[model samples]
Target: MDKIIESFIEDFKTEFNYEKIDKSKLFEHYVNYVLISKIYPDRSSLDKINVGGTRNPGIDGLAIMTNNHLVTSQEEVDYFIQDADLLDVEFNFIQSKTSESFDMGDIMTFIASVKEFYKDGELLFEDDLLNLRDLKNYIYKNSIKMEKSPSLKLYYATTGKWLGDINLTTIINSGIQDLKSLDLFSDVKFIPVDGDKLKSLYREIKNKITKEIIFEKHTILPKMDKVTESYLGILPVTELVKVTSDDDGELIKTIFYDNVRDFQGFNKVNTGIKTTIERKNANDKFVLLNNGITIVAKTLNKVGSAFKISEFQIVNGCQTSHVLHHMKTSLEPSIFVPLKLIVTTDDDTINDIIRATNSQTEVKNEAFEILKPFHKKLEEFYLTFEKDVNKRLYYERRSRQYFGAKAKSEKIIGLSTQIASYIAMFLNEPQSTQRYFGELLNSYSNRLFLDNHSLFPYYTSGLAINVIEELFRENKLNYTSKKFKYHLLLMFRIQVAGAKVPINISGNKDNEKYCTKIMEALWDRENALKIFKSLELKLESVLAETKVLNRQAYLTRAFTEELLPTISNAKKEGKLIYYNFQKGFGFIKVNNSEDETFVHYTELSKVKINEIVPGLELLFDIFQSPKGAQAKNIEKKDIVKKSI
Candidate 1:
């Protein structure tokens, strides 16, 4: 197969002048169309040439016909020869090309040119040329008779690449159908010639013609050129001047170096300018005398202005109070102003103030100042600002950069939950608010929830809020300023109770009752009551403390100590743990063991507990055992340090 393909490619290269043809591939399309059109007899007229010219208006090319009269151009030969005896024949217009790729625009342009030629006063005939006006008159006189003749057609002939996949037969048939729809042409035909076929036809035609018909050598067409131009204009300058001060010795030296480097290759610098000094005090009072001498002995005067006699002094110093003022008045509007000032002052304090102000204009100066203080408060403020800016920019960029189909769905649920929660909180109705939050949490979990680090916090927080809100609502607990404290205490106790512990409770046993006992002890209840009663007391306590305790502050403190620390420690120890307070249970890996242990906070006794730490040995009675190993007897053991 490879050898055959290679041979085919070699033959293709030698068969045609590939570079000369604008569309070498078009030859394949014409051949495919001609072959396919032969399959349908009803479309046989599609194989005919189209007639169109000024003197001999319909002179496209030969057409496919059963009779010899149909083979000739009607307008040029048969019409005049037959005279009143009109011969009826089917024909099509012929478009000849030797290009590989054909553009739609080129086809449109050809159609437009044809339309313009026909509209001109000329007609193209076979034997004698006819003007467009004569052709129209002939068509008008024989309109009904011409309709009786076979319909006109459009024929395209090319010697380029084929338009099929491989066999060169299945070209898109839409182009053929479009040709038939034309009012002037009744059918369409596409004829393709390969290099061998084209050579054979040329030889055959040359032999058939009695006169030597000159054939021009095919040459590649010129392509369109694209060019772009830009312009820069020189502005007219009235004058050029440089302003400086005697005190700016350092700046002057640096400027001089820069100017020398910039103009090193230049011939010379333009220096035809005048210089002047206008001194003024801070109060805008002129200091120069009529004779340029001090009225009184030169001395420090708070209310008096003084000018020192010096070359290269600041120009228009009275009109310009500062460096910014001087730049605005001196420089052109298009030029950028240099943000530097030179002030000559004898007072050390005044010089210090100017130096400090100058340094502040630099980008690194603010960062240096922030580090200099080294105060915790200031450091925290800087960090906070940095983090806020980063987060704000990240979200802003994210919102602008991406939009997915799921975004609408996510936003709807998120916004609804947020609005509902705010309303519930503001109304101080914990139960209603909790139900709303639960709906929100479930919605989030069901739809957008993914086990990603950034999303997990929101998932957990939503779940926690939902659980607490539901408990408060079910128990009719009213959260007040004083009760807020006990509420947080209860929340913390619940969290600690839920910490990792051995799960020995049987699945068949009443888990609620066991959890109720643990809750009663943790909340310091009167006694171990029913599970429902314990839950009620817990909610009541939280409600009472809400009046005095800051809810957010309490939650944060408790979370940091009781929950976050243990999680952090577990991570540091390379242990994996999963917690779900809404379910009142959590799981932690047993040290050096493949087994995982489940703990129920509802069963733990907070009052009896002391100095609880992870990995510390403890004993608990196994109320029920379903699977795996567990501790049955509940008791505390001495802390043991593990060896590395």
Candidate 2:
């Protein structure tokens, strides 16, 4: 492996906590992460797009995007169907190779797999891929909702350089033609990713993007406190497209508002903008009709007529920008867009600008959530634990707030992740965690991030979520349990502090105490792992008997109600009856019963071999192993220390 690629993989492992995953497979995840981040940098759940498991049919990953949002399950597709009249969907397929060179055989096999994926004939594939296929079918079923035919994109990545060999290009072009014959996609393209390009993609994620544009026509706005400089200008539609696009001329999705108010596909307002651009002699008047694009930059440099902006975001003109980019080819050079460019590193000022500029539009209130006082305080609270590795988590109230910082990506909790984690662990809404962010915010905004809510539980939940995901990546928990991770966090909290809801408001001492208990258990790595393993067993048992692990189960409360008892019942108290310290095996007398459950030293986190004693009251959970019912996750609670 190239040293740079090796370093990239190591960083990927740390950011995603993939150390326990096989090294050979890490390259696939690396490719997926880099490429997907290029499209959706702030997307929280990368695993939802990963399908690189057993019987994957030569494809390493797949992502089905509806209106720029990555849709994993059929439920998400249904939501889009109900939410929007027209959907702009995209199907992305990826194949990654760690080998220094790409083989023609592998390339052909990958292309063939994609071709087969669209076939009506039955074929065996991994469950995740099957789900994606089902989702694809669901989208097609409601073709009326589609704004246009779905776009098909394929990416083949390898460590070798793509020298653009004519033979390889011809082979790939031929394969693309075959797929295009299916007539299922508006456009079909296969992008070859080479070693140098992969490195560039990886750097793009962490680096601040800089773009220079001509700013010949502009009026400087009045300066205000916290604002370094502000300008109102008219920029050519061509130059606006340049700022919105990448080197490949694809729209850079990350450089927009990090909220649910994404590019709404060809809506009335956008259609109006599109119509205005297409009208003869009306292109020059576009600056007067459309609300201009607002550019917020951390730093701006003026060189003659060109202005170079770094770390810029288009705060308010998502709709306009998308429309302009879509109609770029038809746009006349005389077409101009109204531009508002502000330069500031102050988050407060940026947030205010974003809120003010978007207030009149159809943007969701959730878009301005980071501007809330609670989030700002929560951001501060996360810093208090920075020196303590066990409780440390960097709260990202803004997009890429922790970028280039020393914090690991795994430990950097974003607002969406935090909301889901807190709602699951503290509010007991694990089932609702998967719902649309707009819906979650609408329903739970009053309950979460309140002015008086104690910040301790938020931090505790964030840290617990981080730990749980790490355990899942490490395979300490059953892989299936990853789907119900929010449930596991709820269960973990119940096991540590009981099922009672804490009064988690400011000045509430009990809230701090309650959250502290959960924190203590999570702070101890061994104890946390034991608790999660036992909870996984309980989760598996509940899910097996009910056989209700589907979209319906997750969207309803009945499944949560059914699963809660299993976790509540996990608390089994027993007295140690017999032990062999030399061999480290024992039996526990069930609390008020004569039945003895087997126990082992391996389940003990607080005790050593000789620390075991007869008649010591133990708190544990029972796991039905091949041998028999055995006590696992044994806690040395209120030990009597009686002699045998």
Candidate 3:
């Protein structure tokens, strides 16, 4: 296995220029081969024959079926079919190409070439046409057949480098429907090869070809995916000696030895320690000795003696109290205690002394000893640290919300544009809106406009202005005002101005004069202004009366209502009241039991408000009682007031 893997790697480097391949990727290739083999077991034992290349214009390879018949070219495909005695099964053509990558264009080209080879015009013998075209046509015409049958299959085997280059979904979705519609076979399959799979198969083949494969192992660690390596080295240590004065007026010398035998040859070593001791009396002298040799001598004015030693000999010098103190201060705390007993022969003896002395230490000195006992609690705190950090993040978000900071200016601008587009869409119907603008609005809002884009108020206003100007220019209407305000106002209500109309009393001077005067009056400044003011007042009044109505209509139809129904019924026994058609217009009923009081149309004038269309909503104040009911006042509601 190792030899095969190594050979695969070498071959991969040469073929694909990939020096380092992941083991999992290589293994996937072998797995794919095993799966394919299991699915098509019969193909494994077919005899391998070199099919002539396209340059030679002949078969590229020949594969014998279970029977001993030879099938050479596509034209001889039927030979095996008829020779059941010698050929009991069918074989598929395997076209092999060595490529750094495979692509859709390559597949298409291969298919096209195969189609050209078996084309109707390429027949050599009359029977050859029947031999090649029969299988080819059958496969192409019924590519999606639901039943299995004897058929010829085409296989293009190449290095799978191109598999990753294209979207597999696109390739599958693009031609899958067409392929399935062909109904050629019970099923059709496309296989993509990758570099890893190819390497594994190549290794397997190379191992079979060469009985002995060479495997090599490197001592240097291969580059890990996401890791680093570090190194540490041990240094040699030398022995030392020290001298000190004991509390009982006795001179003591201690020898310190190096634990590593490699440093035993060193007799003397430098000491990184300095200390001073005062004598009790004058004229006192002391000499420090190690191994019967006087290493240093010093005199003090006091009775006590003092000595200083800068260097010590490994074999002859003794370790004094000052020397021990210097060693402790010189080395790092982690390694100081371990190195102090280097001169001791038995590690167990030193450990026992350390344990006995540690027990005598006070609680304050043993603070570090609790670390082992509280390790689990420390681990729990570490695990929950992330959760605490998340809570702090949540608190920050809450604070931001509470502060109510304005959105970024850029975002505000973007939102304003989006809202403007939305309002435009709402005013106009969706169908008339530009496709791109509609797309932008819909994408931003994640919704479609309900009203037609053409019916937008702004668009309608522009159209109305255009119609009025056209009428004025044609002399159909007169615009005497400085700015044609009345004409503009009339245009808002002249829904039929743009509609087609037939001329009445054609060529009659009297009729023409009357029509001209009427047009002039309609376009008159005062009249136009009157109409404008009327419509404006009406809009305001309707909105004021129907605060929820306009919003409801906007939510429903996004337009003003043109007309609404009103129904009236007699509520009391009354005689017929005379109708008033001049000043006010409405039904009037007189109460018979009473003194025949008249119920005037003026009493219901509040409900007589107009311009009640799909988009307009009106508010009615009703004076209701058992005797009868009547609307006292009509008004438009304000949405902003209600919102506040």
Candidate 4:
């Protein structure tokens, strides 16, 4: 391997904690992450893109993109269909090899697998691949909703250099033609990535973005507080396209503001924009007919007619930019677009500009919620733990914030993930986290992300979810644990602190102490694994007792209601370590204590007395009696026995 590529892999392994994964599999993940970062820089989970395991055939990584969001399940596709219009779709397939050179045979196998994946009633995949296939099928089934044909992108990466052999070129060209003949995709591209190319792509994602554009034809505006500079002008269509596109001519997706709605495809408005630019004489009228684009930048340097801008976002005009980029080749040089550029590092001014400029479109109020001071404070809170490696976490209040900080991609917690974890652990509403973002925000708007809420609990919840995901990646937990991960967060809290949840964790020393305990447990890997193991045992006991085998049932409040009491009892009132049925007396082990209490048959009801058995967990209170400590207020915990 090239020295640069080797160095990148080592960094990748450390950042994602992938030392345990096989070498070949690690390379596949590295390739997938580096390449996909080109299009979607804000991917929250790397495991979702990896589909290369047993029975996967030849493909190593696959990502199905609807609009700009990465879709991993059918439910996500359904969400897009019901909530937002599916304007476009793109399929990204990757096949990586750790070998020094790529072989023709391996290349052909990859091509064949791609074909089989598109065919009906053919080879089936498991786990992530199966979910990707289902999403593909569902997207095609609802193809009518799309304004354009889905695109197909195939990437073959190897550790060796590409010398441009004639035979290999011919083989790749043949594969591209064969895929295009299917008529399923409007365009098909097969990119061969060598070690050198991979290294460059890695640098591209980690590098700070800077672009220069000619801004001569502009009028300067007086800047106010928090505004460095402002400009109102018209940019030529050609110049704007250069700013919106990359070297490969793909849209610069990361430049768009995170809060603004994504491009609405070739809807009535976008179609009009495209049509106006495509017309012979009407092109020059574009500036008058279209709404101007709004740009906000952190730093802007001026040199004559040329301006170098870095760390910029297109706060408005997402639809116009997409349309212009699509019709760039056909646009005339006489065409121009309205442009409003503002330079500011103040987040409040940026959010104010975004909300004001986006009034023409219907953006949900929740979109701007992250821009508030509460989330900003949370982001700052996460930074205070940076000195401790194990306790450090990045809160991503803005899109690509972690990328800008060069933080480990896996260690950065997204806003959505943070909210879900807090709802599950602190709020005890794991089921509600699965609901759509809009509904969840509206339903819990008042209670969540509050200024007065304790920040420790939020960080604790985020860390708990992070630990659960790591456990899954390490195979310490089985597949069944994935569905109930949120539920496990609740159980983890219950095990550390009993069922009585704190009404307001802020300004309460006891609650702070409780959160600190959870943080310590999560910081240590072995201890965290032990806690999850015990929680899983209790989970299995509940499933067996309720006879609820349906996977979806685990997400319901009823299932949680059933599982909570059982686990809480074991935590509040410990196991029955010893029981002498004939003697009518036994010893009970108290939770979080070193001593045991005496239990008598007289404390149990008639029904409970008949069901009494050794090793069964029971909920009871201890009281001082003549003999010392005795068990009272005994109740049964619906949990299986642990051997004494």
Candidate 5:
């Protein structure tokens, strides 16, 4: 072990035989470095993220995030300053202890400390944390005025056994309830990062994006006829609980990273689910009352009666699994949950399954970001963003940099879950306020709920956000009003209506901007009626687009067999102007057009790479790739003699 690990182990050991280890910053560092980093992949909270003091206000650390939906002020037409004292930012509170076990007292102490910070928040030191205190005070002072206010997450980190019970959980629930009753903030969630959870989190961070899991069969279920479908069976709760409560939590974490809803940690509905499982008559109605878990796997093979799944995701039943794990020892041993594990290697199909099944909750969705795997069109659209003032948003493809807690520009133009919700809501539920967004964001387009292209790409939807933000700012709209919220949603709906044959917004560029093409569609009377009366929205457009996208996605199939042409633009006569048979690459010069494009041997017909010499005449279509325009579907053409 490294010196830090060795030192922490010693400190952790001392607590097993005694009341507490000597107060040291080592435990603080361990929780911050290992536990926090593992939980938040962005490592959003570091350096200035921590704010513990002599008499720490129950908070060992924090990450205050500004609301992305803030309306730009008239005073600042372009941007807003990221002063640390920015009001109404989200909060993630951290409280760490170097203790081996936490009893009722410890749990209550943690809650009390959290409540204390909210109630009696004072600047710890006159010099340090002035900015943070100012921000907190601002949130507290103007708590009622905000629409979706700052969220408080009290994270308890300890190198100890989590002594969970009815009383401790009830107290935490009561605290959350009290916070909500007043409507001071958007929401408050409590998370306990005990020693086991911490260790699991650490392991998860060091692993791959996807993880493999084994499920021993309880009984074989009926199978679907689809090729993508798989080993239908019952997964014994007792056996699968091991994966849920693993020291590495890799399976559960990896599965739910992109999940829309999360384990709300001791909510009323979850408690009811727990109650149903633990009741005396539980086994009798367990199968009927309980909605079984949905499992999606990249690849599955039967290991005797057991099934090993690679690149698997538990799209639905996350809360159920969490409840099962939390109340593990108290449950019946013979309990088994029905598993519908689809065994396939398709990435798009897996996302389809996830979006299809994760709709049992009552939580209002923030966005469709979870189904990002299927949003390639948007990913492609974002690349076309011309970096003007209007093209500031980043369609985050890779990192968690989109939702970082930093007050910098990286935080400004990041991928937002809200963006998806807006696109989905406009297309799915434009008129209904009761149901803000559609549950079938993935499935609504097609019954199969596979890869659908009707869903607005991040670039277009993100641009909508920018446009509305700008227009609203220009009109001097308030950020927190019920009317504004509805109008904002309507604005998105209008834009979606216009996109079938998109209209241009700004006077300049003749509607060149893709966002403007979609945005400008809002004003046309005919398009507006088609969208509102006929309810022809983006959802419908996306649903229609999916068929084409699915057919187009079969590029590999096109290479081997007959399929729809992947390239557009009518074939133009071109010369295999320059050829390098040894290198397997050449340049093509169009017959009439002066544009000379590169072509690879692989891009040519499935002939041998050493087929022909230079100056071979060819006909091909020009298509765009990451490396500019390239000649595709090269076919040899015979040179014809003409009267000279």
Candidate 6:
């Protein structure tokens, strides 16, 4: 146990002993505070004592899932998730029994509460505890959104291990399925944070996940300068993916803690990486064509061919790794990417390496100032917005250069244009965002900044922050988890998409209108949730038959595979839906209708001949062939379009 955690526990006990306040509330407070300060940076949770007493609807605390940028697409949503929509508010239905030990019956009681939440929905919260009545109203206020059940996350936090020998993991999963059978929620992710895990989290609150990395002595290259120890080496694609993308994704995120950037929505840069690794002549010329990864680690150890890293972050090569990971079906076991790993504890050096490697590479990365369009518009909006002192939102194109902030402006919040691009592009099209997000500084990234959707940095920041704050402030959400914040964002995406007819928001409009409907509705706290809700029956039918998972689920492809057709069906719009390489042809199942079309490999471009294997998503036009409607001009979806 960490001494800090022990001290916190002692102080908590002492405070409750001196005061007449409930000890359980103090325990809940301790857990909530640790979760906010440690797991979520720049986030806080409302305590049970602060919110409600016995009526607290089975929830102990309320946490805003802020750090979530783009996560999984497991839950079915009406629209694609956007950057701002990514922050989900979750209710922690806490069953914190701070006693020495707990049994199966106690676990069942917690599960039963979760079951009741699903059964009664908001109506149950009418007389329920923890200020949840407000939350219940928020859910029904937008009938369209309420049509679909809210996602519920059940958390059982305890100070003691289970006394019964029953397998809690199995029991929890069974309970989740049971709730599913009851149709209590759109989805339920049950987490039982055992005593050991709870202690681990408590210990982690004080000391973050920083550890020493060791590289085999022979594999590391000598450092050029005494300023720091840097190494150049090679590691198989397997190791790289394993190190960067942990199963649930928390581990890899910890590695990139300082970068303060999430992987851009998937795009061609990442897609090209897929094509590069899957190409026939990869090992021969990949080293020359591709720039190697730039990584930072705390320690390095090199013992023969063995290499171990306590912690590391890839400053560059995010696309390469992401693509290599997603396209692993086509990966070669022996192929390698050149790696340059720097071992340093200095924050300045780490940032320096990131700036240098990103700027000095063959594809030089541009600064956030490139978000001039967004910056300009925001400045204009604020000219008038400033009059409303409480409502003004300042957009910062550069990092910490806002003269207003220098003057200590009360409403100033730093908005890196880089982050704005992330928000705007992601909200516009999740598919395009995924294919292109990582290359924001590259020329290819300009696709995200096209004149179609004018940048609104103030909107970029205001839309997201305000909506998230309102959702939490008004108790409109179900559950919040740092691990599942991505869930909330998905729900928000539906709200924004609901604001405008989906078609008008498309590129069909010569001048695209950035989604302001959700923002406007959110600003006024109107019936925002109605957007996706009314479409539930329609969406359920579509999602039931849909075949692609959105780009967000790519990180956990293995699990996503369990939920097949993992990405957006928008791109696979008119193209070949499914392919069979053995027959050199495939079928395109047009959504809604049971119509199928035939496509042959010969009909598509031969450029990706070898890469044209089964399950390679493609786009094509129908041409008149003797074999009936023939698929022609077929192109792989991941390939970037060249100038005519």
lDDT tens digits by residue: candidate 3, 66-123: 2222332322333323322122233344344444456566566544444444455644
lDDT of each: 0.29, 0.82, 0.30, 0.79, 0.50, 0.47
Counted clashes in each candidate structure: 80, 0, 61, 0, 3, 47
Candidate 4: worst-modelled 10 consecutive residues by lDDT: 635-644
Candidate 1 lDDT tens digits, 462-570: 2223333333333433323222322332333233343322222233133334343343343332231233244445545443544432333222323222212221112
Spell out the clash pairs found in candidate 2: none
Worst 10 residues of 5 by lDDT: 70-79
Q: How many backbone clashes does candidate 1 have?
A: 80
lDDT of 2 by residue, 1-644 (tens): 77898898898888767889987688998899999887767547588777886677579989888878787665567666766667888899999998888788889989999998898867688766776786788889988888689999999999998888888888999999999999999999999999998988888776799999998899899988998998998999899998989887888888985433688888888789888887877877888998788899999999877999999999888888888899888887688888999999899888888888887866666666778888889989999988988778899988888777888888888877888898888778887787666556767877888888889998999999899888888888877667788988988998888765656779888889998999999999899999999988887777777756453455456677667757756467888889887887889998876667888777776765566778777887664332456776677765533421
Error of 2 at 114 (Å): 2.6
Clashing pairs in 5: 367-421, 368-420, 454-542
Compute the lDDT for candidate 5: 0.50
Candidate 5 residue-pair clash tally:
3
Off by over 4 Å in 6: 1-23, 33-53, 62-94, 103-106, 112-153, 167-174, 182-188, 208-226, 241-252, 264-292, 298-313, 317-335, 358-644
> Candidate 5 on 305-346: residue-level lDDT in tens?
656565555667777787887777777756777667676555
Q: Which ten residues in a row have the lowest lDDT in candidate 2?
A: 635-644
Q: Compute the lDDT of residue 363 as modeled in candidate 2.
A: 62
| Top candidate when judged by lDDT against the true structure | 2
Candidate order (TM-score): 2, 4, 6, 5, 3, 1
Tens digits of per-residue lDDT for model 6, 38-111: 33332212322233235443456443221232211212121212332322333345566566555567667677
**Stretches of model 5 off by over 4 angstroms after superposition:** 1-34, 37-60, 63-121, 124-200, 209-229, 248-254, 263-272, 299-302, 358-374, 383-414, 417-644
Model 4 per-residue lDDT tens digits across residues 1-644: 77789899998888787767777878998999998887776555466688886677689989888767777655556666765666479999999998778789988888988988898884657555765785688889999988778999999999998888888889988998999898899889888888888988887676766889998789999968999999999988788888888877888887884646877677778889888876778877889999988988889999988988888899898888888898877877678899998999887888889889988778777777787888888888888888888888889888776665558866888887888898888777886665545456766888788778878888889889888888886778876567688989988887776555555546888778888888888999899999899999988887877755444455466676667666645334777788888887888888788978888888766236657766767777554332456666577765323322
Candidate 1 vs candidate 5: the lDDT winner is 5
